[model samples]
Target: MKNLDYAYLGPPGTFSEQAISAYCSKYGGKTHACDSIRDIVETIVKDEVDLGLLPLENSLEGSVNLSLDLLYKHSELKLYREIVLPIAHYLLAAPGVKKEDIKKIYSHPQAIAQSGDYINRHLSEAKIVYTDSTAAAAAEALKHDDRAVIGSIRLADIYQLDVLAENLQGDLPNATRFVLAAKADKDFSDKNHLGNNAESQFKTSIICAPEVNRAGVLHEMLGEFAKKEIDLSRIESRPTRQRLGEYLFYIDLMGSSEDPDLIEALNEVEAMSGYFRLLGSYPKTVIK
Candidate 1:
């Protein structure tokens, strides 16, 4: 397959950059930096790149709602691949900066949230500051003697900062799941898909909204999958924005779209749903 271009959340040293770098190293691609998730989506929708990689969810933070919202708003985009990157946040600050001297903690909200326990225990007195990205937080920390950043270790080297603490995240198995999104019109060769082995499993994402908000309707809709024994990995609801209380459901199921049982279940769900969309099916990468 020919090398492709990818857009990822950036300003360097972010986990998003790390995720796409690892993927491109194996799959063959060039990486471009986008300032935000919306920027990544916009580039793909505009055909500015071959794919846009953005964080979909974090084990600690649950899900990146902006990613879900963007996927829902843009019908032309599809998830072509997903990668789970292990997270290890370090307390980084400029040389000569002491932990006791720190008066503020800076990081992207997800990173800050993931390291909440550590922050509370070690730097409880410090004020929390949110940045667009972890790398951006590192940039901000570089300028302030009393500020420290919680981010990837790479930030230390990139910003010439010292690592004051390592593995600061509260969770043992911290990770962020990222997905490569592409325009539906793009033709992806087999090489673009990973886990091609015959025994490989796949994951499918879909969006559905009930035709009516009757009682037990959500349960009834999910029953179709339950009856078929199709495993659902996740289900989240986002406001429809068309109504006061109505919502659109985003679901991730553990099977390929081509599976007979999944297809049957999906058809049933669609009939009962006023709005339904098959986001895409992609190879499932098991994270060790």
Candidate 2:
């Protein structure tokens, strides 16, 4: 078997690292750590690595905007597979500290957002500090006495922080969906078999900007999918970053891009929209 090199977001002990390790373990491959998701994607694009794993969305936090923005801006990479790992957040602190001693909570913005209700109820007087990653926040908490960090339990162990609490996020079935991406020509069909079966389910994503003053433009876009009975899975709008009121629409549908109905929908969308891009067709992540 050929050896594979994989890149994931890390200083280590991140949920991304855990997900990457789980995927690589089945294939006996080594995983490399990257500073950011963009770096991971760029590593694959430059042939510095064989694959890249990146978080796409979380069940509690909705879409990861940076990942979507990066995907929208980078056209050289392709989505090869996806994995959904159950999320279990922990509150970690230095060994001598107790849960009641914590005066502030720190974690990645997504983590903080996911655990909002819990934080509001139990740590109402605590301040929230957003860090780059859960692991990073935990590392910082290790050097402070009054701070607690929300992150993976594995991170607390790795950093030698005590677990003040477990499963801090109230979402019982919380999970994060990650994408496996590679350069345009890399074959992923084999790994597809090794990954989560949920990764094998078909899904297509596209981005578009509708023309202004075109009455029923949104309706027309939906009509293409509805006319063919194609189910729309998600639709989100993000600012174009060009100007106020100018926005781009990201759409996910339940079918492969190559499916006849999907192809026809894209064709019609291309004719009706000002600009459009097909993100990729890949398997959907199964939420547990």
Best by TM-score, which number? 1
Runs in model 2 deviating more than 4 A are: 59-63, 125-130, 144-147, 171-173, 191-199, 211-213, 241-244, 285-288
Instruction: List the candidates' TM-scores in order.
Output: 0.89, 0.82
lDDT of 1 by residue, 1-288 (tens): 567899988878888776777776775788999877888899888888989986777732223888898898999889877778888899999999999999998888878877888888999999999987888899899998999999888789889999999998765557788878899877776654443435567889999999998889999999999999999988888898878899999999999998999999999999999999999988745333
User: What lDDT is reached at residue 18 by model 2?
Assistant: 74
Error (Å) of candidate 1 at residue 42 is: 1.2
lDDT of each: 0.84, 0.79
Candidate with best lDDT: 1
Q: Please provide, for model 2 over 1-288, each residue's C-alpha lDDT reduced to its tens digit, 9 standing for 90 to 100.
A: 567788888867788877777767664567898887778878887899887877776632223788788877877777766777889888889899988899888888888887888888889899998888888788889888999999887787688898877777785557887877777677756753435545366888788988662557788888999999999877988888765777788888889987998899899997888878877788754433
